[model samples]
Target: MKLTVTSSLLALALISSSADIGVHANTPFIIEKSPVDITLFVMSRCPDAIKCESTFSQVFQAEGLPEINPTLSYIGSIDETETSKTELDLSTTSTTTTTTVVTKVNCKHGPLECAGNTHQLCFREFFPDYKVWVPFVTTMNSWQPRRIGESAYAREVAERVLGLRQRRVRRFLSLEEEDAEEKKKELEVLLEKVDECSEGQRGFELLVKSVQNTLDHGVGTSCTVFIDNKKRCVVDGGVWRECPGGSTVADFVRSIKEAAGKVFRISW
Candidate 1:
């Protein structure tokens, strides 16, 4: 899936989404003031990706942290030579729909890994709040080797995390306002919307764009960490190495705060 110079340009053309000067709607939203852009290149089914994301989750959840823009770029290979189109069909008991699209991207794990990647992307699209989707993805990464790529498992974990969030909000609600049955229905609806996106044409488009971005960045390895568009660290063979500043959570927090200070002339 290595991309030559010609194939790289072709891969960029496959993206149907708009490309603004410095704006990407599909990627995570960056805070305008003092934001540190952090992108993690990963594969959904890779064990190293799980370990890398889990470590960064700790960094993100650390108390009294500055504004940080976190994004995930899935790792895959795009082959421009393939001209044949593959149809993605998402069928249910009541209806069936097919997405006719040609994707040259090939994931390292398998087709299931591609589906899992799309599921995470859909979750990020449906729930933009990092607090919600980040933890949900981290939890899903925990359920690896067995339930990594199953659609049912994706829905199950989404409900589980969404319920946890709803309960936290429920604690602030008055007893009269708390309706458990109504909350259950709302959760079901939200899950259904995400499921549709993950199993439909939008999902395929998202994956293609993600893989295109990965290739554009020349990210060939899983668990590669990029901060401020520069390679900062990487997790390979389940271990962190080649970190210039340091790989510890404290080191990353310090680096981010330093970067923020330089960007905004304010200390954290």
Candidate 2:
């Protein structure tokens, strides 16, 4: 598929109202720290990607003021194939409880007649013990698809669907951990900034921008902040704002914090 790529600049503004209070280089806003060793893959053209990016940017811009440990490094241009492969591997292996059966049958009758034959005179089973194994195989096969699908969905939900929010929460928590006082102050400032940026903006345009910006620079696919080992998020551009069930950046962020808190024991 042809991907439409767009570029927008994220100005990490460290604006000071007065000259007496000079913005210090070591004050943390301007210095770009390595993000939390995470990698994110996103298409520049995708809406969900954009949403994820903006959320992280907002979070970083908000939390990255006074410096914090677990720096979030934002890498550019993810290899889609590699990301997909990694995701697939993670999905396939992260599952539990899989069963498979091997069956061996001996018959003197023709292969076509085996199905029609009901009497034991035409066929004999070499491994009578195999019958006991049949249930195990059947159970395994029955649950295999569910296990695989759940793992895949889990990864998708964690990485692609809920990634931006997770990264934001993680970064926020990291900031809190590194310096609670600093994080609190920065969060206040960030919230003010968000209020200002969102002022006079309303409705769908605001929603789109929120999602788009998040993906482009903040939390999702196109984010600059890295969280774990892989990109903490993914953008399903095809589904972005295409339905009412689609969530806003704020909503997603809230949900992410809640979910991550449950899973990773990190509070936002």
Per-residue CA lDDT of model 1 for 128-226, tens digit only, reads 888888988898987554687789889878877876444643543332345755665676787788999998998878988998999899988889998
Q: Write the per-residue lDDT of candidate 2 for residues 1-268, one digit (tens) a residue.
A: 1232222111222233333246443353432333232233332222333455444444433422322222222222221121112222465566444444433222122222121111111111111222222222122223332331122322222222212324454463554544755554554454344333323233123333333433465453333323333233344543443223234545434433433333332221
Query: Candidate 2: global Cα-lDDT?
Result: 0.31
- TM-score to native of every candidate shown: 0.74, 0.20
Give candidate 2 misplaced runs (Cα > 4 Å): 1-39, 43-51, 59-234, 237-246, 263-268
Question: Per-candidate RMSD vs. true structure?
Answer: 14.5, 28.9
The weakest ten consecutive residues by lDDT in model 1 span 168-177
The alpha-carbon deviation from the true structure for residue 41 of candidate 2, after best TM-score superposition, in angstroms, is 2.4
Quick one: best lDDT, which candidate?
1
Give the poorly placed runs of model 1, Cα more than 4 Å off: 1-32, 80-101, 164-169, 172-183, 264-268
Candidate 2 residue-wise lDDT at 27: 53
